[model samples]
Target: MLFTQAKGRNVIALTTAESLATVTGIAIAPAPARIAAVRVKTRGPGTQVTWNDVHSFGPDAVTVRTPDTIQGDQDTTAPTDKHHDPIGKRLLTETGQNLGSLDDIDFDETTGHIKRLIMAGQDIPGERLLGAGTYAIAVAAP
Candidate 1:
């Protein structure tokens, strides 16, 4: 799901199966990989959660925050560098062949890594990436 759509969903603590948090924001890493982390707000005094530790995702809720899990960094919501946001950027091959434009990203919830790039209704494996910057996302020629 797009980060824009996921912003306000309820965040459920999996261990308790309770709704204790709401997704507040997302942090996109400013590199070719576009690793993303979610920021969640809890109902306690300064209780905030941030990480890619999503257990399951659904239209109604997202399960997260395990009992023995350490909370992720709070400052990951903001980008740390000058790299471009990949969404909407053009998709091209290393040979300069135009494929399409990036539409969304699919990530691995277990490892917090980007798994694929969704572009023009097609799935491009993250391993095919060559570079992602201000211009476009270049992948290996297929």
Candidate 2:
């Protein structure tokens, strides 16, 4: 499913129907190009919902086993470790040619594997993903 499709979906607690947070965005770990963590409107990690914390990514909602799964601000403190979230970052070639801004990502809902990246209307396969940081999302030159 397209990652954009998940934005705005409610984050639900598995033990109850209560809404914990709203799906706001995600951090994509590049090279392998997978969703490293899901960002939510709430939760203690300053909007982060680590992959390990997610119990399931359902069509209607994202589920967590418990509220504790929503981490506090105590995880990895390195700023460099948080550079992979690439929603609106510019897309660039490995040689430094600008492609465009990344609009969205197509990924497997269950596995979190990125399938392709959507920029404008073009689909760049996930394997072409080279790297991601706050500056740009790099892809292999065609």
lDDT of each: 0.63, 0.78
TM-score of each: 0.51, 0.86
**Per-residue lDDT of model 2, residues 15-133, tens digit only:** 87688888877777766778878877774544567886788998889998877666543563312233555878899998999888988899998888999999896889998988777
lDDT tens per residue, model 1, 42-142? 65532334454567657678777673332445444443123455667798998889998988777655454666778776898777877666678788887
Measured by TM-score, how close is model 2 to the native structure?
A: 0.86
Q: Provide C-alpha RMSD values for all models, in order.
A: 5.6, 2.7
Displacement of residue 84 (Cα, Å) in model 1 is 1.8
- Using lDDT as the measure, the top candidate is 2
Scored against the true structure, residue 96 in model 1 reaches a CA lDDT of 88
Give the C-alpha miss distance for residue 72 in model 2, angstroms: 3.8
* Candidate 1 structure, TM-score to reference: 0.51
